[model samples]
Target: MPNTTDIELRGVSFAYEGVPVLEDVNLSIRSRELICVVGPNGGGKTTLLKLILGLLRPDRGEVRLFGGPPRRGRLRVGYMPQYGRYDPQFPVTVTDVVLLGRLGRGGLAGRFAFYRAADRKAARDALALLGMDAAARRPFAALSAGQRQRVLIARALCCQPDLLLLDEPTANVDTVIEARLFEILRELNRRMTIVVVTHDLGFVSQWVQTAVCVNRTVVVHPTSALDGNAIRDLYGDEVRMVRHHDFLSKGGHDDE
Candidate 1:
């Protein structure tokens, strides 16, 4: 088994400009679990992520990681942001980007050194795991969208994190690439806990064992067993759930 439950949000609340985004949010994620968070566009999904990363503080209650504060929790967490936006002119190569993940474990000066042989090996191994070893020496700007995403994930994995947090790991990819990405995620989750925020509810139900549905308030489901009424209540009419009978009659596939 893994260490402690890797994450906990204790009655957390957050607001901006006097308007609340998350209220009375309480959640606990155990080690080696794969959880998917789903809701409408502005349902505080990202806000919850920020709270767990300590990028934002809760207005009312505490957020803890490994039984401590989030900043102190950094050593155990690996975070993959929704978008990778470095400039093409930037001089970093894929190796350099992945090596950045080692900084937390190796100290601030680790990036400048040749890096310990073990650390370099760890970075290379992470790349291989993500199937991005060929692009390891390529300039980060030269890779395609899916390749870039895999590299970012490789970078996060280089941290040897116990808990990995991802925001829209499949956001802009086509269907085929998204399927491949989730396959990788399943393998990763066997060793590390994963918490991802995504709008693609169907994509996660295929693999995730837990669901966190958030709006102003948050609810937890054992699986992605959300019904039409629950979907309507969470996202309103503009994003209602599809009816199974109607969808089947129309020959609509579940993967759509």
Candidate 2:
């Protein structure tokens, strides 16, 4: 079911200086759904997510989130970017990093320091929810790739957002860990709307209920089901999937 309460973008276009990145893209994201945006490199995937996040305004069309602009009610959004590298000697603990998510709610200028009991409780609870309680005091520099990824998600969850946006959530993790991350996202989707941008064909077919493709142009497939034709339409006939099964398998998986 499409979420009745969600975001809608009509004829949206964005450009950097005079060069266009996204051209008249139309999209709608429903509440309580998981949508994946996929495309080749330089395909404006990141640009589109930035538009949803309201970090950049569209050059031509309108974007509405929850009945209004993304900027007006951004606190309800949580975002986790592609895996980030950290300095080994940064000296920040996992708990400290997760606590950063509360900065928005806690206010700025020393406001977070005077945390109410509820705020502290929320941060701790978020860490536990992501299974990071055991490493709450561990230095972020020392955590493994998968553990760090979970911490980033925990940081995002601390906001208790109605919508969560992740860019390349499995970019650096191994396949086993990537599968686990997808499962975690499936569970998360039951509680919040999720929008992910990736080139991973495998995850898209297995997890997403909707697909959005951007390549200077954007197309949205609202139906959860997809076929080889749809895949080829977006990625051309060159991009290949690991497994030899299409989302609507019966037909052998091939980009063409």
Candidate 3:
């Protein structure tokens, strides 16, 4: 079942308040494929993820997950949005935040129900996966941006999803943390499909098999297509292509 298609978007177009975002987008993601979505700012990267997650209805065409509507299949999908969107003022502990991922697992009516022992165990296990177990009881707001990002990833992992979606997973972390994070993700990809939305290709090229370049329109390309010309076609010529090794060696901030 490794070749099983887990996500598909056919002629999908979307708009926000009458402004066109994605247009006639067609994308297919198979099981256990590690993908990185890259694009310039305001290029509909996050919006595409939302559409795949079933959070937004496409203005035209269709989005399907696991051969069904997104709503039905999103339960098996884990999502981590951008880190900048949070206020970092939550009084909840790290464990409590991760448990939020289990919400609605038992359906809408059980959303507020007490967390089962299994749920707590799953949360702990996810935290452990991110090496954040020691800080499980720490105040969420007190952690640095890197630590919070790890906690959020653990939250997404708490679902034990068949598909995992992440936005700007390496936004605040340094190169060292980014390397470690990708190491964990590469390991996770053995069991689940991963679609990461990041701005930089070099940071993720070592792990991702494909690159989904998003803009007003969407295009899917193999990672090998990421030469200077391809990058300029997506980004402008002003942007330089950074090799993964050169980037890590420079200790560059690969923020999104």
Candidate 4:
């Protein structure tokens, strides 16, 4: 039996003010698959994500989520953006932040209703999944960069989404935490489909099953088929490929 596809884009094209950002792109994401999307900065990576999120309408083609219009299935999707800025003195606790995920289902009424006991339980459960339950009462601003990222991920999980999307998840963390984050994501993939937009290729070998390379157009490759030449072809001459072992040891520790 074939795997069910959670997302599909067919001949999709998008442009900003008549300047094309993505053209004739086609891709499909299978349920429970972990996919990494890599591309040069400003090479339509974010644009493609927006299309999948149904935040942007295509100039020419189609995008489908769970075999329907993307927006129709939005509740089943969770998204984490590249940069989320929070004031250091902001008075939000980790649990409070995770509970925001419930807004999608409850909307304004739920907030007015105030979080029910079940909602609080779900938020705490999500935090536990990321090993962040202990920090539930801590201020969001006091956590380390990695901790904050994990909390945001927990917030996404609070939605109980079938599909999760993250952009540059490891951008600000140290190598150890970066490795740990991927380990967490690998575990999450067993239950939910995940699409990550990242420049790092190290995780490709051990975690991601597929890679989507985006430029003006998009191409998908099995993780095993990715190589130095293929990466160079996608990223051009300025790019370099370092073996996974060069940075990560056999025990999965950063060699630094």
TM agreement with the true structure for every prediction: 0.83, 0.81, 0.86, 0.83
Model 3 TM-score (2 dp): 0.86
lDDT of 1 by residue, 1-256 (tens): 6756788998899999798889999999988998988866556888898899899999999999888999998778888886556677789899998888888555555646667777789889989987889888899889887777778888888998988888877777788877777788889898889998887876557778888877668888765445546544544422442342234346433333
Per-candidate Cα lDDT values, in order, are 0.79, 0.76, 0.84, 0.81
The per-prediction CA RMSD against the true structure, in angstroms, equals 6.5, 6.6, 5.9, 7.0
Q: Clashing residue pairs, candidate 2?
A: none
Candidate 3 Cα errors over 4 Å, as ranges: 107-112, 224-256
Worst 10 residues of 2 by lDDT: 237-246
lDDT of 1: 0.79
What's model 4's lDDT at 199?
A: 72
Off by over 4 Å in 4: 85-90, 106-111, 227-256
Count clashes in each candidate, considering only residues at least 3 apart in sequence or on different chains.
0, 0, 0, 0
Query: lDDT score, residue 74, model 2?
Result: 76
lDDT of 3 at 80: 92
State model 2's lDDT: 0.76
